[model samples]
Target: MTDDTGYEFFEHTADVGMRASGGSLAELFAHAARGLVALVAEDSAIRPAETRAVRLRAASVEALLRAWLSELLMWFDTDRFLPAEYALGAVSATALEGEVRGERFDPARHTYGTEVKGVTRHQFRVEQRDGGWTANVIFDV
Candidate 1:
């Protein structure tokens, strides 16, 4: 369940799942965004030439995780800004604030062969384990 970069990745029947541990909520959200970006593009290869602002609120940490991913998808749909890197200014059980950098999505520049239809509720899970946050997401890949 480890990718070539050594980040653990688990592929289920529908989508993929990964785990990242952080000392703070901001770091955890940042890492979670990184993991999601890796699912579509190479983290290092994604050019950081554009910036975007995002604000999201949820009822719980698990909902916040889904909201974060949904916001990324919205940015991709509207601006074509594929997220390469993300920095979280704040995060909590119900809210998140962050910025992501990436190149404008160009079919020539950024080739995402597989289409992610959308995030799904099936098997969706997020939890805190061992003093760290873990998110299990299933997308309609």
Candidate 2:
């Protein structure tokens, strides 16, 4: 994350890669969710008109990260929810509980640059360095 507590997009051949970092794991994961939002819409314009509690279980932190994003993406594609703010409550290597805040994706009001079809495991990672934490994830466009 640079100026904002957010994530950055990396150039991928046919998809997109995200590098999310923060002072803590919850922050990093929240930024990662913001990264996914950045991939689809303008975060600043998205109003927190609704909130959805997201819960997931995984075999590892990496899997949990992907599952979290995947659940959000599923909401976008199926439930039409476009998340902007992430309120990560409890998170561990195997479990996560969080709430995503954003209203349903209204194409008339929201500006989406691209359509992220799915999240991929390729080059997916979650690591904690001495200073902070970071994660890398790829998305299928």
TM-score of 2: 0.91
| TM-score (all chains, Cα) for each model | 0.80, 0.91
Flag clash pairs in model 2.
Answer: none
Report RMSD (Å) for each prediction in the order shown.
2.7, 1.6
Best by TM-score: 2
lDDT of 2 by residue, 57-87 (tens): 9999898888888888888888778877778
Worst 10 residues of 1 by lDDT: 1-10
Each model's lDDT: 0.68, 0.83
